[model samples]
Target: MVKPNRPQFTDVEGLAAMVGHGDAFGVGGHHFARLPVALLRAITRSGVKDLHYVSWAGGLPLELLLEVDAVAEIDLCFSSLDIFGLPPKFRAAAESGAIPVRDWTALAMIQALRAAQQNLSSMPFQLPQGSDMLARMPNAIAGPDPLAGTDTGFIPPLRLDTFVVHAQRADASGNVQIIGPRALDFAMAGAARKVLVTVEEIVPVGALRQDGRQSILTRNQVSAIALAPGGAYPASCLPFYVTDYQALSEAFAAKDTVLSDKLRLPSGGLSERLQEAAKVSAETVLAMPAPAQGDKKASVDEIIAARIAAELDNESFASAGAVSPLANVAYRLAKATHAPDMIIATMSCGHLDIAPSPMVLSLIESLDCETAAAHAGGDDTYSTYYQAGAVTHEIVGAAQVDRRGRVNTIALRKPSGGLLRLPGQGGMADVANMHRDYLLYIPRHSVQSLVDGVEIASSARGLLTPAERDPMGYRTGKALVFTDLCVFRLDQTSRELIVIETMPGVTHQQIRDATGFAVTFDAGCRELPMPSGDVLAALRNRVDPLGLRRLEFVSAKERGALIAEILAADRAMLERLIAAQKSPAAS
Candidate 1:
């Protein structure tokens, strides 16, 4: 698949030349998958400065860009390193107010892009009726809704000077082939004035015709194509390699804030790095062993996951945002066991209606995204599900949740009467009200987390009654709270969370002691119904072989060890899968 210089092929310097200083650049990919990292590196290496960096899911790519002070401002929904915690650069910049920022909700950010895509000055999004997003930003405008009578919010278009994205492969003719999740690349490509693509490999002109899904972006849409193998090196690029987690984790734990030399690739270094990534990805791992067979004593994490999975029936539709392995596992387990027809969308938009695959963070985008039926952007997902009120279930986490079902993911109150900044609400604010079922899970069920009241309600479920929701074309939903100790459901009449069921060993007294507000149990309360033997088997063997569900439950002190174990298990699994794929019978 060696590519000759046809019209689209360009060098790294040439690709970087297309971008200018102080440009509103739209970046593609969700979380840590298929990011045009090599292209970003090239831009920074070329000493481009004062960029208005834009991203739907701003994480590692944002960090890399910010490392060299390339970004003077940011427009993104959320930024975090997932399990490793908040991105250091983003946190520092945000805390110090060193850079201008436009923190957006998932809906608002996508709506802006959709506006640009449709050639509109502004696009109408669902009004955040119960969310404090408008109050926080003070920039969103209200649009007249003559049709439904419900207030509609309009987001100004986020026109991009340049858009950068990575794909699995592209031909010399600039026909890009993305094997797994397109995420927001197609939308970004439509919204940008110029599209710059970095491909893992360059095939012949007709080679991409083998699959229609690969040919979505035409040569006309692309401004230039660059030859960069292992472009999304640290991130997962399906059909080639998964995330190099060891390198990423090392970066996470590294004291140095600057980008690692491994990531800051020279022109010739990319090929060598790609080869090393391939060799390391499939190598046998021995640090962690599989859980023992057939004895079905469930851990607290397994019990919670099982209980959550049981809530979903065959008709259920579930969605979970990024960095949520527990919810991701539950959705997959439910679909694999009883709820085979249940639809699941995870990693925000990267994996939609995904098939049950091994729950390894390293290969999440690879395995899950590849098996998914469809991938969408923020706009596509919100329009179809959130705005339409079509999603039946969404498992959202909270930093602080009150007895009134209000959640705060924005900031925490410090004892000194200041705010301890937390990760901003990444559409949890919208989904809390919009989704048909508000499923809140808190791994830690302490008094601090299960608060009496939230200082600021970043997200709260508002449409509990038909009178309020029906008139607005919204879904009437109830909040169900899942914790390590007990399960609570919002008493619709009271609009207050009451303990409905206790975990296997948890007692009423313990629940009362842990809760911040006065505790009341439901009249029909019973113990949490444990999963069936078949369900447990599906979880252990098929869905979560690496025990990734425990990630949410582990402590900050214990997280390092748990991540190491999971990574080792992930490498081991990849080794076997790759070997199986290469087997004679598999071929």
Candidate 2:
């Protein structure tokens, strides 16, 4: 049933030789985790041209492929560098209008892949109302549903020619094993004609069968296997390493050049070293002494986190998407303090119903799975949580939000003429209508961000009244917006954002001056309650030990130095996790 004799035993260079011009290519991993870097390096070096790259959640891999003028077209759900900021090459390319890009929503992307794997011509999906995502998404057929006479959209199958992934271990028989959080890789493999895999370890067929991790791509599905230990470096490969943020930041700084030699480490004696180091890091985290409480000045990050935590109930389903460290902190802070039973999903990886872990960088990759009650990919997550309306709250950041609650995450038309591109609308288009409480946050809110009208409505649910939503089966809840200045709640009847309370230092007059629209607040208005001792302690000492939330508040110029400091501390812990034989179970 497999294709006729795609090379079964080859190195990365040999595999790279197989990728032809204009082939639809897929790269594995979610965000900065578990990507096939060695293979990407090989592809970049090989000088293949005019390839159509498909990355459902594109990150470093997408950027790397764009280095040598290889990718002619990119079909992606989003392109970002997560906490580091925008993907430089991807952003520059989009801003310059050099290469063509097709921005797809998360759910639509998966549905397209599903159609491909299932051998269907096209897949029909429910079009989200109250947004213009469909207008921006090219190649999608949107109109009245001929069958039901309701709104609908259809996308052609994402037929991929080749796909590559990195995994913990694989056998000569081509059994690929992923230790944890196999995000979108399975769907990619299923949809592609040729599946190439690189692994951290190549084990005997018998050992591969007996390994505790799940074997996702069977021998029949895999076309080739390459042995490359620590192949997923710079990106975390679970028990092997956490994201090499220092290396990644350095690579980003280097501009368009490929820094493979400096980034990839020799795998010999690496496992033993990382295993021992991991044990030490685990002990350090577990044995960390509590900091003494005092009049330590509270940061804006802590204030926002505490305020968001206060919104949580004892038992609610909350989700923190990729690149949202503030939401990550708030959800964990809420669980560690008041809402003991809060169920949280860590990232787009779908680490569903995870136990609250410390807000460490490694926690998103290592401890997330160790502590998670269950794990699934993007498809299962949407089906079970997002589409079912089980996710009560999801806190997302916006590039531009309007008085009517519409968001612009796609791009902003510049006064000078061209587009000022943002990270493409990831899942916001679809998930905007999914969560029970459609919560949005803007870390640095000003007249520019809180606009009268957004340039592109990538996602919105501004009208959330029971009357408007009950008939559509959408969740009826408040559309709350949080910012550095104050909190604004959307008035469904009026369909406009209204001030609820100002921050402690910010006055109503300051808010009015900063806002682009009309407001109904003055100097004598209620301010958000100051975070108490317990809340501050939890934020400072207990939850966010690495200060990940501060990444959101800092300016682009300031982020490098701040990231270096945080990543250095994170590296020490990850080095230890990588050394341990059996990672200490997440608690």
Q: Where is model 2 more than 4 Å wrong at Cα?
A: 1-7, 143-149, 213-215, 255-257, 260-262, 266-284, 290-294, 521-525, 571-587
Question: Mind giving the per-residue lDDT tens digits that candidate 2 earns over 203-318?
Answer: 77678667563636677778888887777877777777666666677877775556655466655524444333323443345444434445687878788889999889876889
Local distance difference test scores for all models:
0.76, 0.78
* Top candidate when judged by TM-score against the true structure: 2
Give the per-residue lDDT of model 1 (tens digit) for 405-432: 8888766767876546667778887777
Candidate 1 residue runs with Cα over 4 Å from true position: 1-8, 264-296, 475-477, 584-587
TM-scores vs. true structure, each candidate:
0.90, 0.93
lDDT of 2: 0.78
